[model samples]
Target: MSTPLDIASLIDRERIRPFQWTIFLLCFATTLFDGFDTQAIAYTGPAIVAAFNLAPGDLAPILIAGTLGMTIGAMTLGLVGDRVGRRPALLGGVALFSIASLATAFASGTSQILVLRFIAGLGMGGCTPVLLALAAEYGPARHRGAIMTGVLLGLPAGAMLGGLLAARMMPVIGWEGVFVIGGAAPLALLVLLWFALPESLHFLVTRAGNDQHAVRHVLARIVTWPLADDARFAVHEAAARASVAALFREGNARNTVAIWAVYFFNWIAWFMFLSWLPTVLKASGLPAAQAPLGTVVVNAVFIVCAIPLSIALPRISTRRLLIALLALGIAIAIGLAYAETSWGLVFTLAGAAGLGIGGQQIALNYLVVGAYPTTLRATATGWAIGMGRVGAIAGSAVGGTFLNMGGPGGFYLTLAVPLAAALLAVIAIRTNEPEAGTSLATAAH
Candidate 1:
């Protein structure tokens, strides 16, 4: 009998190669565009409101529409990724969002803008979980956390890009022009992804086993040596198809519940801040032109801290790290309540919150990846984040209401409550000691 080809071992033992970097960069690009389109509405909210003669509260429907689409997409499209393949699902998401963004430029009224944002959000929500799954599968077990963390950096990077682009282009191209640029750039990158990006090797060797040649081809690209023609490959999962319900089975119930709770609480607070911070800054006497810089500062520090923190996560206890970060987040929220008195203090709190809460956000994502078998990794991630989108929708809706109430202090204070709840959820979660080598193949069993 031929020895079974253990792909998990191959990736774990082999030296990191250029192909892995290529995969990481491609996923990074997908996330970058996802972030850009998601935040485009926020960055251009003032302009969109001015153009339509609307109040800040009116923007809530548009924000909630996109997040609602995200909720739907994360569950449905995420199931598509698990049932079909990550590459196609990812591409489909990119196409949907790109087209919706282009359509947003021509929206004539609130309803039209709301519909287009909902469509774009479907794609945005679907892309992120698939990207995280792919990054975990492609990266060496030792470095998977860092690679996925790096991939997620694209989110804040895209936000930073949106802020800078809006500041520069709103003058020349108008808000519609910003959407046009965001739409156009991603469409171009979509072409690059079609040609250059490979499907997840783990998915191929495991999920698409009927196509043996394709599996060998992808393996050859990542493996340092050539594969033998007769080499047999196998993933340890049972023959039954993976499904969302599987996440609740197989000793995963507690983990699934905890993961969803964390995502929901964290995103609720995070999106509320993300969606309205610029307007709040503007209300606090920052120049219309400069209000976005507060968000820019927050995103910059988030990306910077996220990169190094993810690299260090493999060496530390993720739960402890998360608790510490959430505590810091609470402290920052308190400071933010008092920050309206000074732009200097506001900027300082924003940057510090980015470092604390931002790192916790990324760490929670990494924890989710490790909590499930590979067969259901994408499904579990999608559902966790999908449910979290509900919280995000609530955040956007509530932020609008809070803004209407006319006090920045209350908005900041409300956000702290969710952060504290999420911290407690982390403290309550229990799991088998995390596997040191969390490869897709090993994770599947």
Candidate 2:
């Protein structure tokens, strides 16, 4: 008695639903937690120093501990996220970071807090790359660019939240309360995920060898489940037989290295700016009290630019877009060397830097999802990020050293080197996807 239209509606109700909003919320909450976790350490730095009667030198180990832990986490969990399922990998990351953060609240000594923060850093590292992979999987083809940007911008938003929280409550709650807040938020998210967060259908289909029930549920929520052949999907027909080694064969090797290079340089430059920017500002004549506010300006522009930047990306070629943005970033950083006391001039140059960096980040997220099969998606993304973490550590350390030696020119020049490499990497990089496309991940309901 049912017409084809009726059958189509039924399929939509049960299969291949566009995953636009569902994926967005899933990623938004996770990115918020990411921002909160990363910023907590800086916010707590002062209180910890005072409480422990610590010298600035004494704090270096604590900072290094987290970076070391994060490096390990990125490599280990990242590999696992690729081998296992992204959903489980992501959940595991959240759990590890959340528990580690909570553990910090109870620590009575610097040594104890160092271990806890390191543990949290590992988890934080695991989350970002894996989460990026997951966001790409659930999102619609056209919407991938915007969704990734929307989700990643949450990181800056989270950082801002930590700053606001510290400003308001550090007096009352101190460092312990700040970490408790960061730790507890994800615990709440874990519950919400259990009830509503669905496994990414793309991951299920490509990585888990397909499940009609899950795939259908996710799809049906969209206008209807797709009833297409295997070719419509990027998943290989031979994927069941394909190991990750397949990605390294002649067809994919150059692409892999280029991607890795891009990630490494990108993070080095990014962390250099983030870790050193305020210090650089202070040296440029801003009061110490006001120097930290420069981060607010940088991140504010970054978060604001994310939406428009991402919306624009899908329309352009990925390689072209990424290389162009990185180039612009390099130019802006050079310009900052000349920007002294002109607040308006400085902010404009700073925002230009944010624009370039923000665009590059969004493009990277897009590449993480679309460039590989769902099975290796998390792993590839994770490894790239892990390399970046290493660069961040080096960048932070070197930026500090540079600041000590000279001034703004010295600081900005240090960042310029890595960024130049990133630009070159972008040029060499090629994705499996064609030049350009669009997607706005959607659900039928």
Candidate 3:
């Protein structure tokens, strides 16, 4: 029951004096744009269909390809980030995605477009985990929760931008113009990230030796404490010492597996709702015009939850927060099945589901990363992300199959099976103190 973890002192935001707020803001903006460009295609789907003369079912491959690409990028660049540092990983991922967007503008066929999208996805995937690591490493300790909020809030904002641009820009430049802008804009910012964003001080102290000039500069600016000793740390060597097998080395393996399991189900439930809800709403008596608006409302609710979740997370036990959100998600799925009316009950359930989804996502990420030590942070995050993507793909792909068979009610009710699994999984994540030698891959804890 007694753990030496100085979490309270470690996380003091007032003491987070080294990293500049401006730098954190920059990282947040970069991720926001990444989310926007990635989702822009979904907004342009109607136009892309008209231009390419494609069918509803025909676009699935493109979506799948992109998702798969992102999955690979997350795994690959995640390891690369640990070895080479987050800055290069961030820059490379952004550059790759930007070029893919440009290539999409000249897509000559469905196959070409699909390939381009997949490449773009690889970039997007690479950006997220590293950006998260970057944010965690560079931001003030106490402000990590709020900083995550500022960084991730860019997503909904980006989605809104995509929606606005699709409404405005597509008319003038067409879908091709949209892709051109998506590709070109990030490429432009690539120059700015290179010059303005300094490597994380924690990262530099660990990997680059005691470069007092850089370390002292960043430390004095970012952290509130003025320690007389300036010791350089090596994150890569520490990371190299961590093996996949180490995740289970302590009794903590079970907890690690528990986190993965909950994430697995949460992702499935969320993506399933995203891909099928609008279509199901239309089928269940709502007008086609109003169906997609369900997504907008859900997203709006998600945006509202972002700040509250941040405010709540560090104040609560991570495992407890994870389980509560998962339970809420399960209840929302069932509630959605019964709220069949134009009275907006369905929209309310959708919004609540959005809240659960957003909360669970943030909690899961924080829990997984914080649960692990510095060396294996990205790998732990990568596996959790990779597992979640499997659910996302299943949700998006299989929801279509469900809709073809029954309707919205059956379509949503079926997803409750996965939510149930997620609930059970999170319930298994017990509160325990962190162990120094615990590997994150095990499930015994």
Candidate 4:
């Protein structure tokens, strides 16, 4: 009788292969486009305001609409990923966003823009957690943290790229052209994903109803050893039924709740900064032409720090690292509250804030992906992100309100509260180390 082969151990024991790198690159590309489209509206906000003859504050509803859709998408498609497969769920998300973004180019008014952005958000929200799940599963156990972080870097990189493109493209092609580019790139990427993306091997073996032959074929590509026709395959990790409830099972409840809290509070500060910083900078006497660059600074700094942080994650304590990063964000928020409105001072603070906020966001995502088993990974990550999107909705709305009520000082000061809460939430989490695929037997006991 053939013995059962553990899929996770099989990957851990092998050298990194080209097949894995291809998956990483594909995931990176998907996230890159997701970032571009997600932030496209922000970059194009001023132009949209001008085009529609609307007040700056009117953008809040549009922002909220998108995030609300993202919340729904994250929760819904995340479950879909667990039920069907990560590849199909990811592809569906990309297709949804691509089509929505293309439609945004032709939008005639705020209502239409709101609708299009919401639809685009659905795709954005849905694909993100699934992509992270796929990337983490494909990555080796020893380097999973770094690999996941590298894949996630595409988000900020894409956003930074959007900022650069918007600065140049908006001048020549207008906001419509920016949307057109945003929509088109992902549509092209969608085609590539449909053809090139592979299903997660973890999912193939662990999930019911998958073809055994297909699993063997994928396994053969990753490993040099030949598999017998009757060789049994398994993922040693605890299996949960394909449902959201699985997130709370197998000693995951507290970790799940804490993760959601961290995501919720962190995103309140994160999206508030992302959604309003450009406009806030403009209001604080920065040039209209340069306001969007503030966001670029944040994302650029984030991209710069990602690799080093990723490299450090496995070597350090994740909980302590997360808490320290949140503390840094709190400090930056306080600094921003008192800093003068000069571009030099504000931009300097923005970069520092990126280090704190961006680092925490990436690390938290890494933690979530690593904390749960393969069965619950996508759902847990998605729900956490979905909760964060809800916070993002609040952040967008609160940003406008705060700006109108007390200006930049009040807005920046308020951010510190959420960062502090997130710090506490991080402290509350019980599972802070990389799980690296705990065995079912180990987990149960």
lDDT of model 3 at position 392: 78
When superposed on Cα atoms, how far off is each prediction in RMSD? 3.7, 6.3, 6.2, 4.3
Task: Write down the lDDT of every candidate, Cα atoms only.
Answer: 0.81, 0.69, 0.69, 0.81
Question: Between prediction 2 and prediction 4, which has the larger TM-score?
Answer: 4
Q: Model 4, 283-324: lDDT tens per residue?
A: 677766666788799999988887777667655667888888
Query: Which of the predicted structures, 2 or 4, would earn the higher lDDT when compared with the native?
Result: 4
Tens-place lDDT digits, model 1, residues 1-445: 6988777778878877898888899999988988888888888887887789887778999999998887777777867988789999999999999999999999889899999999999999889878887887777877765676678889899989988888777877888998998899999999999998888666776678656688777778778877888986665554554677787896888888888999889888888988888777766667666766767888899988876776666556678888899899999988888877688888899989897666676677556656765667656765776667788889888887887785788778887999999998887777444555453223433
* lDDT per residue as tens, model 3, 1-445: 2332222233344554434666777777777678767665565655665577764445566767777787788778877887777888899999999999889999888889888988998898888878876776665444565666678777766665655665556667887887888888889888889987777555565566645477656555655566355343233232244566777767669867977777777888777676556556656876543454566666677888877765665556767776677678777777777776743788788778777765677567667745765666666666777789998777666765675665667776777788789888877766553443332222111
The number of the candidate with the highest TM-score is 1
Q: Evaluate residue 246 in candidate 2 and report its C-alpha lDDT on the 0 to 100 scale.
A: 57
Give the per-residue lDDT of model 2 (tens digit) for 57-155: 355566667777777776777578767777788888888889999889899899998898788888887787677767766554445555666787888
Better of 1 and 2 by lDDT: 1
Clashing pairs in 4: none
Q: Which stretches of model 2 miss by more than 4 angstroms?
A: 1-23, 43-60, 78-88, 133-137, 168-173, 199-259, 278-292, 317-324, 335-348, 364-386, 407-409, 424-433, 438-445
